[model samples]
Target: MARIPGRNPWLAWPAGIVCAAVVATLAWLALPMVPVVVAWVGESLRTATSPPVAAPVEPSRAPLLEIAESDDAIDCRRLYPDDLWVELAWRPEALLSQDFSAPSTSVASLTDALAPQVRVTCRWRFDGGGGISSTLARVASDSAAVVEAALQGEGFSCETAGAVLRCRRAQGGAVEEHAVSGDLWLSSVETGRVPEDYGARLAEGLWGAG
Candidate 1:
C-alpha cells in the first residue's frame, strides 16, 4: 500500500474543540474587565484636568473690653462715653443693720451706726446728665443693715419691703432709690449688672423728685 497522506482525525477534532472552548472562556472573562479598564482611564483623565479645591477661611472674634482694678473695686468708667460712668466693688465680709428709720442727721449718720460692725465694704458710683448717684453694700452683715447703709449713703429715706430695704434720695429734679439685698446694692433702675429699666426707674424717681 502506498503511504497514506492522511490527517490524524482524532487529534485534529479534539485539538480544535479544546481551542474553541478556551477561546469562549477567555472572551467571557474579558467581558467584565473591559468596563473596569475604561473607568480607570476616565478617572485618571479627570484627575489630570481638574483643579484642587481650596480650604475655607474662618472669621475672627471681637476683643473683650478691658476693666481697671482699684483697691476697692473694678472700674469701667473709661469704656463708656464721657456722659456715662459706672463703678463696682466686691468685699469679703461686712456688718449689716436692721432696716431702721432715716436718722435726723445727714445720710452719713446711718453708716456711722453700722460702721462699728462692717468688716468690708463695696461701693459704686454712676454719673450722668450732670448728676451723680452712688450705691454702697456691706457684705457679711445683715441684709437690713446693708440696705440701711445704702440708704444713708444716698441720703434717702429708708423703708422695709419684705426682707429687703429700700432707700430714696431727692435732689434737684431727680429721686433715686437704693434697693439693698445682702451684698447687692441695686438702683431702682437697672444698669450694668443691674437692669437698664431699673436704672431708668431710679433716674426717673431721682429726676422727678416728686
Candidate 2:
C-alpha cells in the first residue's frame, strides 16, 4: 500500500484564524450604526400612531329680537312691560281700542305682504280722539331693502340710530315712523293727539331702553 499523507493539523489553524478575523471586522463596522437604526424605527412607529389636530370653528351672531315664531296674534299686554304702559298712560282695558279703525298708512301694502307668524300688530286708542297703530314685522333682507327705499322715496327724514334705521314723516297731526334693524321692520302711525316721542317709546318697548 502507498504511505498515507500525514494529516496537516497546522494547515487548518490558518483557515480558522482567517474566518475569525472576517467575523470581528464585520462586527466592528456594524456596531456604530446600531443606535441610528433603532432611533429611525422608533420615530416611524410614533409618527404612524399619532393623532391629527383639527381647526377651530367660529360662533354665530346672537339674534336681536326675542319673539317666538307663531301663527296666532301676540297679546298687546305681553308686548310691553307694565311700567311702560303706565308711563304712556295707556288703559289695559282698551288694548284693541276698537272705537276707531286702524289708520291707513302708506306701508299698508308692505304690511299685507308680511305673514302673521312674523308680524305683531298693536293698536291703542284714547277715549278722546287720537290713537296709535304700531306693527313689528320680521322680513327678509331683500324686503328690508325695499322698505328702506320706499321710505326714502316718501320724503321721510331718515337717520341711523346705532343698528336701527329710523325714518319719520309728519303731515298735520298725523306722524308716521318707520325703523329697520337687520331683518326687523317697525311701522307706527299716530293720528291726532299722539306723543312726539312715540317712535322712540316704541323702540324702547321692542328693545331695551338702551
Candidate 3:
C-alpha cells in the first residue's frame, strides 16, 4: 500500500481508548460523594427558607381594690384603713349582690331569700386570722329602731354607743352599725374569736378611712 498518511489510523485507536479509560476512572471515584453533596444543598436551602419563631405573651388583670368608684361601690382600698394589717379579701360584686326579695331573719342567711339590697360589701382579713367584713346598705335614720330590733331578735345585744349602734355578746361576736351618710348605713361585723373591742377599732379605722 502507498504511504497515504504520516501516522496510521490504528495508532490513533490506542490514544482514544486511554482517554476513555481516564474519564471512566474519574466518574467512578466521584460517585460515593453524590449523597453528601445532595444532603449539604438540602440543609442550606432549609436554613435559608425557614422563618424564626416568637415567644408567648402573658395577660394583665385589674387589681381587686382599684376598680371604678361610685356612691354605691367606693374603692376598697380607699375605704380600708391604712394602719391596719388587713387586706382586701374579695370584691363586693362577688359577695354582696342585691336582692329586692324579702329579708331573712338569720344574719348568716346570705342566700337570695335573706340577702339585703346592700350597695357595697367587702371582706378584709387580719394577718393572723380573725377579721371584719364591712357593708354599706340603705337605711334611714328614722328606721334605726327597726334595724336594732331585727338584730336583737337574732340574739345580738345592740346598744346606742354615741352616734353608732354597737351589738355583740360576751362570747366574742360583735358588730358596729353607723349612719355614715344620710340614708346610707355602714355595718361592720367582727367574726367570732377576735380580741375584745376589735370591732370598735375596726369601726374607727373605717370611719377615718371613709
lDDT of 2: 0.65
Question: How far out, in Å, is residue 169 in model 3?
Answer: 3.5
Per-residue lDDT for 78-102 in model 1, tens only?
2222223322222112112222223
What TM-score quantifies how close candidate 2 is to the native fold?
0.55
Per-residue lDDT for 1-210 in model 3, tens only?
776778877988899999999999999999999999999999999989999667776643223223222344554454445544242333232222232222222354322322344655656455445555666555554455655666676676766654556555433444433333234345665654444445555555543222
**Could you tell me which 10 consecutive residues in candidate 1 have the lowest summed lDDT?**
61-70
Compose the digit string of candidate 2's lDDT tens values, residues 1-210.
564498566877898899999999999999999999999999999989988667786743322245522344555555655565664565433446322233246756555654322355677777667777876666664455666677777778877776677788997788898776666667778887655477876675665432
Q: Count of backbone clashes for each model?
A: 21, 0, 0
CA lDDT of each prediction against the hidden true structure: 0.44, 0.65, 0.51
Q: Which of candidates 1 and 2 is the stronger one according to lDDT?
A: 2
Candidate 3 is scored at a TM of: 0.41
Residue 165, candidate 3: C-alpha displacement in angstroms: 1.8
Better of 2 and 3 by TM-score: 2
Model 2 alpha-carbon drift over 4 Å, by segment: 1-64, 68-73, 89-104, 112-118
Candidate 3 local accuracy as lDDT? 0.51
Best by lDDT: 2
Candidate rank order under TM-score: 2, 3, 1
